[model samples]
Target: SSAVTKNTKIVLNLESLGSLPADEAGPLARYASTIQAQRHDYNGKVLSIRAEDLKSLAIIYDMSPDELTTRLIEWGVLSPGADVASYFDDE
Candidate 1:
């Protein structure tokens, strides 16, 4: 007798709902709803989070503001094409 391992991948889509396995989908949808409920609108952009919002997100992600900022830059969410040095000058 041979045993086979089954693996399932869940991809979340923000634009529209897609077919998802019921067992896993319900929890994911609830989690997404929670996040959506906490979201703040920024200049008409629902997804653009402000620095003040970072306090809550940092607590959730267990990170400091500096760490979160670094991660955001690495993730290409902040300062996508700007040079870091330009933001700071040698004293």
Candidate 2:
């Protein structure tokens, strides 16, 4: 559940969300919503994934956390040297 909540917060904080074209924001928001719903289903249970697992999940989505951070930087979503994990430290 924390994973879900943490991920939701991270998504919400993405500066790119505001600047992204509707076509992009729509899907990203939908994905965040899905994660939110899944979190709700957990009823406060903790997710038991490690950072590496999170990285693997990111890969399934076509990026690693580092890659995502880089993309966010490229999109002006995050400061150039931001620590990506800080956005989801709960995980």
Candidate 3:
């Protein structure tokens, strides 16, 4: 969906996949990096996110979909009515 896709793009554009130099970027960072790479391959097309994929993302980030959605909105990665889960479907 656009939320996942857009957010992924933002995360990917980060210098270090939104990670710090303490040691590792962690699971969320890793997932975001992967998503970003995919987006780059598609020229920034929104990635299709299944429920399972969303679950994995949540697990990695330790957040719920709603929470993630809210965070994405806060970060300006997702706009209202974006319907992240349905964005790729439209494509």
Q: Top TM-score: which candidate number?
A: 3
Error of 2 at 52 (Å): 8.5
Candidate 1 lDDT tens digits, 1-91: 1111111111224333224444533443445556567764222222433334545555656776556546545544445333322222221
Candidate 2, lDDT over the whole model: 0.50
Q: Residue 6: error of model 1 in Å? A: 50
Candidate 3 on 9-75: residue-level lDDT in tens? 2222343334354233455455655765776744442334444565566666678766665555554
lDDT (C-alpha, whole model) for all candidates? 0.41, 0.50, 0.49
Model 1 per-residue lDDT at 53: 56
Q: Which order, best to worst by lDDT?
A: 2, 3, 1
Residue-level lDDT tens digits of model 2 in 1-91: 4444334323233435556776645654455446657667333222222445446546655776767656656666445544556555555
- After superposition, the stretches of candidate 1 with alpha carbons farther than 4 Å from their true spots are 1-46, 80-91
Candidate 3 regions with alpha-carbon error over 4 angstroms: 1-29, 36-42, 45-48, 84-91
TM-score computed on alpha carbons, candidate 2: 0.40
State the local distance difference test value for candidate 3: 0.49
Lowest summed lDDT over 10 consecutive residues: which window, candidate 3? 8-17
**Model 2 ranges with Cα > 4 A deviation:** 1-15, 33-57, 85-91
